[model samples]
Target: MYCKNCGSALDNNAAVCIHCGVPNGHGERFCSNCGAEVAPGAAVCMACGYSLSAQKVAAPGAKSKMTAGLLGIFLGAFGVHNFYLGYKGKAIAQLLITLLSCFMLSEVSAIWGLIEGIMLLSGSINTDADGNPLGD
Candidate 1:
């Protein structure tokens, strides 16, 4: 790993940069993969071809945390949040739990959604189907 703030080499488990005191994966001055200086507006590392695009920098689709949280809170019984996050199988299961049971066991699905919603809001569930970090 490398310090995003200082371009300094980093231990994989490092939480902060020893040279700059900045958190890891927080800087934009250099390439984390190659430690090469990256110019503003450059989409990738000219030397190593490491993509510097939004997906690379911000975790692919950048799923919205707020949207997922709200869906989990409001339509969780229908697995709305799971669907939004691309967990299709799990989402379908939740949806069926409520729909197939004709609401008799809706509480089960609702509680499940509620817990997941809380997890999303609390950063416990922070990635989407593509392993993208949820956007704030």
Candidate 2:
């Protein structure tokens, strides 16, 4: 294997490059397959025809869509769903709207949350604040 950041030869089991101190497969400057320097934004390596495009790696333990949708449906007035989805601002807004108004304006937030929950269940809102796709 090779360090994509520095083109240094790497042990197959190494997690980082000894020479560059960068995580293995972390950069696009060099090809990980053959240690050849690669052009920035190039899709394939000129030396080995290896793909240079970064693959989409799903985050471990992604949040569940069903859970988020249910939270939105049941506790949306308190912004529980937005909180679970990492949308702190929206969550806080929803929470404050319901709480500060002494529950008088809760229906507004509740309706808002219901629409969002429907959107989540229908895949209209598919990703969390970190841009990770919500899992089933």
Candidate 3:
């Protein structure tokens, strides 16, 4: 096999690159299939036709749907849940609408956040800011 981090040859069983100390498929410097240097953000290697980007792999510490849902339900007026989910813009808007207006229209923001919370718990809003699916 090859080390995607450094384009160095690797034992098939190796978990990380000896040269770069990065886990397999962690870096974008070289094509893992052919050891050709590729653009940092290039999707595929022109020389060897190897796809440089890793396929969507589930992460070990994906966010929790339940936690996000509860946060949205309880503290959505402050946009806490949206911030936790990485929807910074939405979070700021909700927070401002409630805080800046001195709670005059907090119900509007609260209901909006409550619905989002329900959506999150119901699997309708499943992805995080990076588009990674939330964990159960």
Winning model by lDDT: 2
Please give each candidate's TM-score.
0.58, 0.58, 0.58
Error of 3 at 73 (Å): 0.5
lDDT of 1 by residue, 86-121 (tens): 999989999999999999988998999988998888
lDDT of each: 0.81, 0.86, 0.83
Residues 9-113 of candidate 3: C-alpha lDDT, one tens digit per residue:
987778888888999877777787888888776656878876554454347798888999999999999898899999999999999999999999899889989
Clashes of 2: 0
- Model 3, 85: alpha-carbon shift in Å? 0.8
Best of the candidates, TM-score: 1
Which residue pairs show collisions in model 2? none
Better of 1 and 3 by TM-score: 1
- What does candidate 1 score on TM? 0.58
Work out candidate 1's RMSD over C-alphas: 11.4
Q: Rank the candidates by lDDT, best first.
A: 2, 3, 1
- Model 2 ranges with Cα > 4 A deviation: 1-58
**Candidate 1, run of 10 with poorest lDDT:** 52-61
Off by over 4 Å in 1: 1-61
Model 2, span 1-136: residue lDDT tens: 8998999999999998999899877988889899999886565688998756434333678788789999999999999999999999999999999999999999988999999998888666777899887776
